[model samples]
Target: MRPQLHLTAPQNWMNDPNGLIYYQGMYHIFYQHFPYTCEWGTMHWGHAVSRDLIHYEHLPIALYPSKYYDRNGCFSGSAIEYQGKMYLYYTAIRYAKENPEYIHVQYSDDDLIASQAVVISEDGYHFDNRDCKHLVVDVIKDQNLGDVRHTRDPKVWIGHDGYIYMVVGSKVSNGCGYDGEVLFYKSEDGVHFTYQNRFIDSSIGDMWECPDILTIDKQDYMIFSPENIDVAPRPNSNAVIMPVAFDEKTCSLTKLDTYMYLDYGLDFYAPQTFVDEYKNRVMFGWLRMRKPVEGENWCGMLTMPRVLTQKGGHIYQQVHPHIQKLFNQKTNTIDFDEPFLMRISMLENEDVFLGGLHLYIQDDCLWCNREAISIHEDKVCNLTHTPPLNQRYDLEIYYDGQVFEIFINDGYYVLSQIVYKIIKEQTKIKNIELYKLSKIQ
Candidate 1:
């Protein structure tokens, strides 16, 4: 079967996807999935893959919490292809009796296409929990790796310094403020790692879940999603992507100037990357909304993977251009220069909120309305001016796909919202007027 993803299985949980490994022409993606209902409970690793990362097929559950170490739930982690074999390192959990979390390592050699491999690892070799399901670094423990609630999502990457490094999502000493950072460590061998630095810490969001690093043409990029829920109107999923540069001088990481949306639409996060057969840096953003629409059974899905590019130190992600063919519907050319009404027909209603209009002056202008961002917020931003580019913004309205996202000024500012089940065609939105336009690219 060319595996397909359905709505979130009846459940209360599912946040991050951990192990993303590409092998022998096949990309294996495992995520945190809960079989129960909309709220988050017993977690398992949901599996899926694709050759092109465009069309995906979902396989059965991959790693269950059936073992003692992972009896509670299996959390986030990452995958690496080292020494001709595939290895997975993830966080396994427990509730009360022994709630402390730890890392679990597993590997595979012979037959590949597996839903769940019982042949885990002992020293990461074909046996489950050979020691304690975790490879702990004793000397590094004093770094004050606080919180018994710690441990989940380990991201490994090879650095420019000719050594492999891994960053785990961890809290700071004493759990003082809301500080979550990507703890760095170095290792000659992919298995036993040595502590490095704080990598990068914003101390901003509630808890940092998945931390994955990507380097393109010599520049390093760190990607992560926070558990912060401060949306206007209501709260939903909070997925953010920031630019991080590694400072060779201090051997640390620094945040770049701007921040962009991971996925402007709903249900998106836990992104992981890999250089495909063509060696192009590609990423997969899981499209699993924290809160599914009212009656929708499934709560999770993954977006078509995208390619990453950097210009002038800024990183931009575009749906791998090849998938443009997936639009499937032929586009219609329409024009509505000057102010006009969309859905809201009446003259007064169609009117732009005057000076409220904002312009994405350049082809790559990115601005954020912190006030406009919160978990489950119903936000409506009105713009009175068109972009500097005189071209009308051609939009693809996936209405029947009740999900609503607005990409204005050539996708400069993405505005996405959740619209309840209503008549798709009768969106009431008809004329889309252009108040102004610019020639800027």
Candidate 2:
């Protein structure tokens, strides 16, 4: 079953989220969608909007593979509002007959893909892609800028100096291994861009995708999803958050501390953030690379909108307050059959043990043998963390149909998955307040 509160395409495959913004009293989100089939194919920009982040209304496709600049696909990117108009900077893909020289060094003669383009809209709902003349950036011929074939995913924003800045993900070779790099560009006008600087070279993963920057309390934070990195207890394609200090004088970023995973789970990736109408940093992530359901026709879902805050040098995430307003009634007893909100906490001087819980398939029955754990079917994804002896551990769970989103200690850790197997018995949890969520109209 599809998620009730989360955003997903009505049909077909969806992947990385792109172009998140708020304009004209509505929150708009765009994503990589293949509408023709359930499998990954030609990508298009699937659009949606919501007054409140909890309930969404799907709109028409914003961008498609119509022009030569983006004939291959419309990949990931970001959006900005300029002079009451909406501008979308996206990775427009086009295949070439001959492979680039850089691709021949590391890959065979078969791998060659390039993307760089921008589209504008007078109204936020419609975009212009009739001609390829709207192209702002072209294929890079500079060898020092890294592999041009691998350069994509443009993230653009306006700096305090009123100059527009863009960051694009690319790959650079370091004699022994290929390292991920993000090339920077600056434009006096939002369309024409000039090369600035490159950052996060060879220190992170081999390839970075969907790069973004968020500023909170005058502190800069860089976010991106890296590939080919070994991250235990989580997927290798994980999003990372690094605290960075931006030097306006030099137009560069200095790493202030080490990077950490944004979510310690299997389903989160390609997260993007935007300032909402309430002036809060709201973030949404694509729930990708998960096990497919047996008979489901649709795939991919977005994580619940989370408000980000930095406290004591750590970034904290919590469910947006607009979502909490959907909880209409509260009760003390658990209802295992319906969609609900659950909050669990440990008592004083007590440790909540989770090791004894066992969820498995036996005799074709979906069984959850432990009181603290809940199970529906084959998906038994859970976060592994030790609780302090005398400290309290809080867990907030949103159960909507077969989807379960677990937020531990106010989102210091999060676990989410879609359970496909059927539930054979009832399960209960203690020290939890159960609230029945009113279904969205």
Candidate 3:
């Protein structure tokens, strides 16, 4: 039950996407990988390349726990093209207990300290961790500024002001407890960085992870995963996007008042974006699995790349054109047992049912329910409610046999679910366009 439209590890475990960039001629995607089992273990950076985003070619492991600073694991980070070389920045992890022999045998836990590090590749494919690893940011010694173990996930980029800017997520150690904040840094060259101020909000969450910065249509936005948020109902964590203003000289971000969830789905988290070859802002996210498959060798998968834009401070996402080209084989009916893509135009008081999933319009809002699916009982959450639809309801749905991704009104809202088995199906009045999707190998 692997995904063909989305990317997964060649075999074992995979998590948050790391080092996503379009460099040289191919687009590269590096991810957090554990090679031993289907479960999480010590981390390494798995590498893959694709000329077109639909198909991929797996490469060697890019970064591993080689140096003393990152001996425990190599956590998540980003990549950039600097001076004709590929600079890959990542969070290097080291544990308090000294057990070098069991690094690959044990799963990472709370007894770890993290620092930011970099590895350069003269070419896009070769990464020599033994000789190329350099520790750029050391572990914090002062507990008042940030938690020593939780400061990590360096996202580096070259700003329009001709300087390299980096954002690392952390938990600020307040007198009472901790607050979520993002640490900023600046550099003339990509190697060495100087500390700058941080952006914090007491109401955001207790901690943040995998912070990303991007500018769309002259507007700046920060995307991050907030942990242990003070909310009635939540998943393991949540991904949010907020509009912000950046100071190039000070390397700081000013957060705006309102923020929105990046995805209203139970299986989405840790989204990272990069500029495509055509300069389109593209995003990829980890589909967080609530429970591991009983006998499968792989555990996690990524979401389909979404092209992003903004209007009135709200981010809009849509399926990439490259993915749309694969669904050229049109059909009159869709089979839930196979991979397929379907689009429908929904009207007020209209309800559409595809297999076990249901979509309906109620009180001018778009709603989705997956409670009828067999895997609904195994999920963290199974219902989605969108804000007012303004009477426009165009829906696009993709089912890769194991996962179902629904896009409402060209991505104004999205809900993704994992469906193991489709029990029943009932279709309403339909003017539908259904197509078969090509396999990705």
lDDT of 1 by residue, 13-128 (tens): 55565566667677776777776666555667776666655545667666666655566666677776666655666665554443235322222111111111122332222324
TM-score of decoy 3: 0.93
Query: Estimated TM-score per prediction?
Result: 0.68, 0.86, 0.93
lDDT of model 1 at position 80: 68
- lDDT (C-alpha) at residue 43 in model 1: 69
CA-lDDT, candidates in order: 0.50, 0.73, 0.84
Write the residue-wise lDDT of candidate 3 on 329-396 in tens digits: 88876766667888888888888887867888988887777777635333367777677889998888
For candidate 2, report its TM-score.
0.86
Candidate 3 Cα lDDT to native: 0.84
Candidate 2 lDDT, 17-117, residue by residue in tens: 88999988888989998887676766789999989887788999988877776776788899999888899888877666523543112243224566677
Better of 1 and 2 by TM-score: 2
Candidates in order: C-alpha RMSD to true structure: 9.9, 5.8, 2.5
By the TM-score metric, which is better: model 1 or model 3? 3
Which residue pairs show collisions in model 3? none
Rank list by lDDT: 3, 2, 1
Error of 3 at 112 (Å): 2.0
